[model samples]
Target chain A: MTLAAASHGFLSPTGVEIAFVLVGIATLGAALMTVGSRQLVHAALWLVVALGGIAVEYLLLTAEFIAWVQVLIYVGSVVVLLLFGLMLTKAPIGPSPDADSGNRWVALTVAGAAAAALVWVVVDAFRATWIDLDGAAQGSAEAAGRSLFRFWVLPFEALSVLLLAALVGAVALSRRGGGAKGAAETLAPAAREGRL
Target chain B: MHLAYPAVLAVLLFCTGLYGVLARRNAILVLMSVELMLNAVNLNLVAFDVWLRDTLHAGQALTLFTIAVAAAEIGIGLAIVLLVYRNRGSSDIDRLRDLAERPSGPDGAGSADAPRQPQPDTGAEATA
Candidate 1:
């Protein structure tokens, strides 16, 4: 890894590296807005930008299939679901003063510390490593499909089962009668009749 | 491309999510932050997969699985947030302190009494 990285000097960046850095900066900015914005709806919108930027990053990385999946799943569905949740919960359209918790300063301090430490470690460790993107794309749809069906069949099937379980669990948890108050109310008549 | 770029980006995004999780009041916003964190992991996986060029392409495959699992997670998480909103008429995480230990009073009221009461006293309780 060090040898490969030594061949490719850090001062001279290729076009791909420049693009990746630019998009990454945009993504990071959008992410910061997503977490820091006072308007709830705008926060979700910023999340869309951030996730979309990540999809672009995947494309630049030559993971074509993963890029599309990221677009479809995250940019397409997740943000919409989040928007629906915000609306259903009656989140204020304008900025709300209490968008952040009281311990936000503490949270900021912790996150800053973590970011600084992790960034230092990752940069130092991977400084000598470089990815060779000159060859054919590694994550095209055909390659991904062949590997998925051939090598990763069992995990794929298991993931389907997990999805099904999640579906049922979500339904069960969201139902009206699942709450403690509802259960207590239902059992009140039984206790009144001395069935116990 | 230098591997440090993606690695560093992932770290920053994950920490941003961490901050959001700890600081955000709304449960849905917190869920969005979780998505950010998961996406960061996906970026790292793809970058490493491209670099390694393994025959099995384990990194990309796992990335797909992670995406699927994240989808399921968001579904379940949204359902839970909706349920909490339905029951309590609010989805602010800080106010949902049903499990938080409180100082004992002379009334001998159990923690069970906390969640059942209305949200009016939440601010006072948080201040105390």
Candidate 2:
């Protein structure tokens, strides 16, 4: 019944494919703009489009769990932090003098080579690999959550620690010169002076 | 058709990001490029994982971890960039080339957070 309704909607396979192609193009274009554009805020906004593309791709692949996480973490948190950094540091909201500097040619060459190599390796390796993909393997959100806590506990715990450390570091970095006379001592003055 | 489609896309995104990181002088952009590269890797992982059909959803799990780590990395990375910008007043990576190519004294021995020009006044400063 639900699948019938879904097919009638724009979420059918053909519709989904069309959506994918359109979104994919938009995503790629926005990503290119994100890198190629001069304005900082514009770049960050483009990043939202790029990240949104990946989330949609995940949805297409039936990886619902990962897709929402992408939206939550990258789009919700990371980009906001990026924007915050831009504002806090008082970077020239206008034309940044050093936005594109000396090594563009070299960077382009190296990036092209790397991309070629990566594509070559993938094509060569997966030449004969058949993908038997469907929605069944993706399972439910509850199942994903269970696996995350049950089997992937170690990595999850490690992530928690990493987040904790980042929180501490952010606090220390943003703190006014507290003169705590500890490991944070070396960091405090610079942060207070906003020289950090 | 094949996973190659996504894989190729990943490669292209990664490379563009790499170029941005290397070619762009702004520290913020470099960080943005780094995020792009990481996302490329995530896409490749998830695509392959879906293709493989393994029992554990290992690729999805790993991508989650990567996102977490990337968040932490950006946090610290931005902090350092903010510091450098404050010290040097400019985020141009080349401005620090002097510190690299030659051995300078305390005169050049501050954080890169200082700016080379006078900072413009914000609304608060304008009113004051």
Candidate 3:
């Protein structure tokens, strides 16, 4: 089996590469659908699909740890938070005229220009670069953790502090309205009613 | 797989997200757009992390940090947007223009820029 694998064509595309292309196309399509969906709920659902596709893309790239993290953080938590935000804001679940403004064309033009520039720069800079998938350091969680704790500890700690601040800020911002305070005050009665 | 394939896909996703950010009026949708862009950046980071064969995997480390920061930012942004929605009746970014400096008016209310003061009880807002 090892001999057969080694004797495989050096220049021909492999199954992994084919799977990568398929997943990439799906992810890109879902991303566009996420932005273009007319219904707010549908947009959120499309976001889930897009995020999940990206997670699969990460897996194909051999970053198993990050792929799972993407699934956990992005697909699980972020989308749920977005749904909570939508509910809290009383956003219409159906099609919303306010989902988009009148500047779609202008925005599309700018986005196209930016994407073109980035692709051109990246292609020009790394045209000759290739990664060896057989290497150990590319995506193993053990190596990632070692490197993270060794040299990137400060930034990692700072990230924790930033998350703490954001927690405080979210609480403060959402606690300002008096009616919500009333709801909190009535929580006991509401719970009692739910018992019935 | 060609690194350009993933890189190109990331760029397309990023561009789509940018369009959403610029074109969407709902604050929550705009936040989702921001998330899309962040995911694109993460894809690029991991791709380059592999391409460079860095023992430290600094790009993946940065991607993790970006994820954490994105989560934090969305939490705070959602809180603010929900507050605005409660105080006013809408979460339109166009309606948030009153966050700019508003001079005082004769009615002891804010200046004409923010024509309505945000009164939480009555939903008559003095602020945007």
Best by TM-score: 1
Q: What would the C-alpha RMSD of candidate 1 be, to one decimal place?
A: 7.2
TM-score of candidate 1 against the unseen true structure = 0.87
**Angstrom error at residue A173, model 3:** 1.7
Model 1, residue A134: displacement in angstroms? Answer: 1.1
The alpha-carbon lDDT assigned to residue A150 of candidate 3 equals 98
B45-83 in candidate 2: lDDT tens per residue? 888888877578788888889989998999888877765
Choose the strongest candidate by lDDT.
1
Off by over 4 Å in 3: A1-11, A177-196, B99-128
Q: Can you write out model 1's per-residue Cα lDDT over A77-118, one digit (the tens) per residue?
A: 989989988876768999998999999999999999999899
User: Tens digits of per-residue lDDT for model 2 on A1-196?
Assistant: 1222232344334555556556666777877888888888788889999999989877876778888999999999999999887776555678665578788888888987997788678766765544455447473577577778889999899889989999899777755454544333443334535733
TM-score of each: 0.87, 0.79, 0.82
The lDDT of model 3 is 0.78
Per-residue C-alpha lDDT of model 3 across residues B1-128, encoded as one tens digit per residue = 55666777788788889999998888998999999999999999999888777877889999899999999988998887766665555687876665565456655554543344433423423221
lDDT by residue (A80-143, candidate 3, tens digit) is 9998777766567778776788898899889989987877776656454555676563666787
Docking class of 1: medium
Ranking of all predicted structures according to DockQ, beginning with the best and ending with the worst: 1, 3, 2
